[model samples]
Target: MNAEVRVNAVFSDHMVLQREATIPVWGTGLDGMVVKLQFHGKQTEAVVANGCWRADLPAEKAGGPYELIIEAGNQLIVFRDVLIGDVWLAGGQSNMQWSLAQTDHAQAEIVDSHIPDFRFYDVPRVSYEDGIVHSPSWKVCTPEHAGAFSAVAYYFAKGIITELGIPIGIIGCNWGGTSIACWVSEQVLTHDDDLRIYADEYNEQIENFDWDVFAAKEAHYKEQIAEYDRRFAAGLREKELGDFPAAPMNPHYFLRPFGLYSTMLLTVVPFALKGVLFYQGESDAHRPLIYDKLLTAMISHWRTIWHHSMLPFLFVQLPAFGNGGNANGKEWPLLRESQLIVTEQVPYTGMVVALDCGDLEDIHPTNKKPVGERLALLALERVYEQPVESSGPVYKDYLIDHNKIILHFDHTGNGLEARGNQLIGFEIADETNEYVSAQAVIEGATVEVWSDQIVNPLAVRYGWANYTEANLVNSFGLPAGPFRTKREERQ
Candidate 1:
């Protein structure tokens, strides 16, 4: 370890370099120092300027247990057990950050999770750049280590490996209870009228930020959390424990707009990758209408940073959740609609529907396997050119025929069918915009809906609630996502 020479924190032993792509190895060193990198008998060099050095190794095929040796003056660094393979970045909030040990069938999955070629690199969660203490290294998938990996990422990698037999590396870059605003750059937030509110509000809060006041509040909040944990471990009821303490807002707060982009995402930029897998939107449910714009801008910003204009971006639509009542809440359905809009408008992007995999009372669904596997299916079909049905039936168009509203959909794999005894969760709206429950029947590749109470149906919506037993599915058994038709009221 030489003080004058250092490698970027992202590279380490057991790391997987993206195969068949130019491998970039960068570091900092004394000015004018010549840094050299050697891997698989291929050598490259760069001169350090402004205390930074970068060397690009020629592309190699997927297969390695090789040593990467770097030499700068007298100091030498060697990273061993490196593999060349496909690498993907898993980015989003809580559902994407959920751990394997917390998911369903965790015990069995952990026991069987011994894939030497599969690896993970969890980006350390830090609110600010200065808060980063140490460089987190990559880990090989094993029974002992797999429990801590992101369950969605683990299952996704497993699915890809089973299909391609190539080494897979997943970089977990996510946080729990985070908004889409937290991941995008500040410049992106400031430019858009609808998105500027997030940045403006954060700036207002931090303008008068006082370190002493924030520290005191944080200390108290920590104490309250410890007490709540102790009571829960002692079998105390949640009602007796009272509500969880809220953290004080500050410049370093994790939820602050652009905080994670500076701290978490920037650390792994320019690292070659296969693509990205995102699972988010729960936090943005309150303002669902603007999500399509926010997400599209964020995707473009990320691709710009990575210098890959067509990077594959696959995401999960928010699953059904009661949000503490009967599953018929409204905000989440709107957010899911926004997600669908992004997938339709953005190129090289896909969305996975999780309408049938939600909990009535719990927000974090434990069935992450389906979510992850669906993402893999999208990658297989769109990225790898494999023949796979990656999506469920998606709303395409509607035909108003007298009193009935007929709905047409794309990706109706084999055809649509109700998952239960009868089709449920359909509603029809009249010219006055008054909506009532309607009966729906599957007809060929389309669904026909009508209600005796409404003669002229102006609009129709299905699975339009926070949570619903929307039993509509394709022949592939994949559930159709929430959707609504746009129609104008008669004057």
Candidate 2:
């Protein structure tokens, strides 16, 4: 005798399956039992093996309010009101996980969030050593649900719905303030010198830390969260709530090495995804020098796991905060530079520059609408082949004539224009590596930079300072991302 048929929690009522992709439906049941699936007037069947069974539903068209029926060993499971359409996974840190209720215009947005074509599914934060755990099911977008959903994810889905006129499903699998190393396997972390420090810390914690103490704290945290949810449902203001639970400095599920990837992302591997939208890297800002390698590795690892070599990946560049200077004085700018490097080097990737949408004093900017819309633009122009202005001016190449450096750019929507009286954040440097403020002007889609102090400029940098409020942008009003050309590039 074996256990009765049980489906993976990922598949349930009100779920939206990916359109134009092989739909994998898997579950556990009695070994060798006959399993059958019936959906959308087509039936596919497979035999249970090793205590598990699977069926592949054919690629479907966009519209669906269909029912999915499964039968195995006298046990039957049915999912109703299911949809078929585009599915995207939302990954990264607090910004990606920030809820709509905490964002700007929350009240008005919630009132108008009646779109039935958009849906969201959140994978609860849980860790397992060996097996998979089911948490929550798919939720349709209503005012109540939309209020608590990820603001960035919600806006991204909304943009897609408006443009494509198809059902959109967003799987929110993110944790706030989580480091990149936590989202990757320990083995992968160990391979890179930049990431091994986190792995070593986790190993030390496992040897010395008290598991019982951690368990007690975790239990208390969950209780507090439950109480907070209750208070929030009763119309309590967020500011009125005291403080959310924070894990101790020692070992915790979200902080431990490979914790999130093993728990949150492993079970969802190989599930069909149209693309991925990531917003993280703030926690890894301390080690800015290694961020580029770490993120590149993470992307490669995920693409391999998904079996999609060229999956369309788009990410939000960290917005400005705290005058763009960390206490260490090097973290923020370096991290932003590393983000730009990935966007330029990665084959199927894009980065949304939030240069003009940052908050000077707040780490978590409440203006997430532009972040989401920018991400959607990347998908629209690059993934869907839509002819749209997806970005602002990007440095293409430069020409030097005696004392002047002329900069050429791509994606100069309409033409270039300085947001202020004159272009700020421009610097000219000579062979000595000393830089001075340069006079800059927009000439159509090109910028001419020069400084009287430096007669022969050897390099040029824009928005290279810690607290730069650059005024250079294009006609579409998207600001140019920060960049600095090295001495080698000047040749």
Best by lDDT: 1
Determine which window of 10 residues in candidate 2 has minimal summed lDDT: 322-331
Residue range 329-373, candidate 2, lDDT tens digits = 445677888898888799999999887677765668899999999
Model 2 compared with the native: what TM-score? 0.88
Q: Point out where model 2 deviates above 4 Å.
A: 1-3, 127-135, 211-251, 323-328, 487-491
Highest TM-score against the true fold, candidate? 1
C-alpha TM-scores of all predictions? 0.94, 0.88
The sequence of per-residue lDDT tens digits that candidate 1 reaches over residues 69-94 is 99888888899999999999999998
Off-target runs (Cα >4 Å) in candidate 1 are: 219-245, 487-491
lDDT score for residue 276 of model 1? 96
lDDT of each: 0.89, 0.83
Worst 10 residues of 1 by lDDT: 482-491
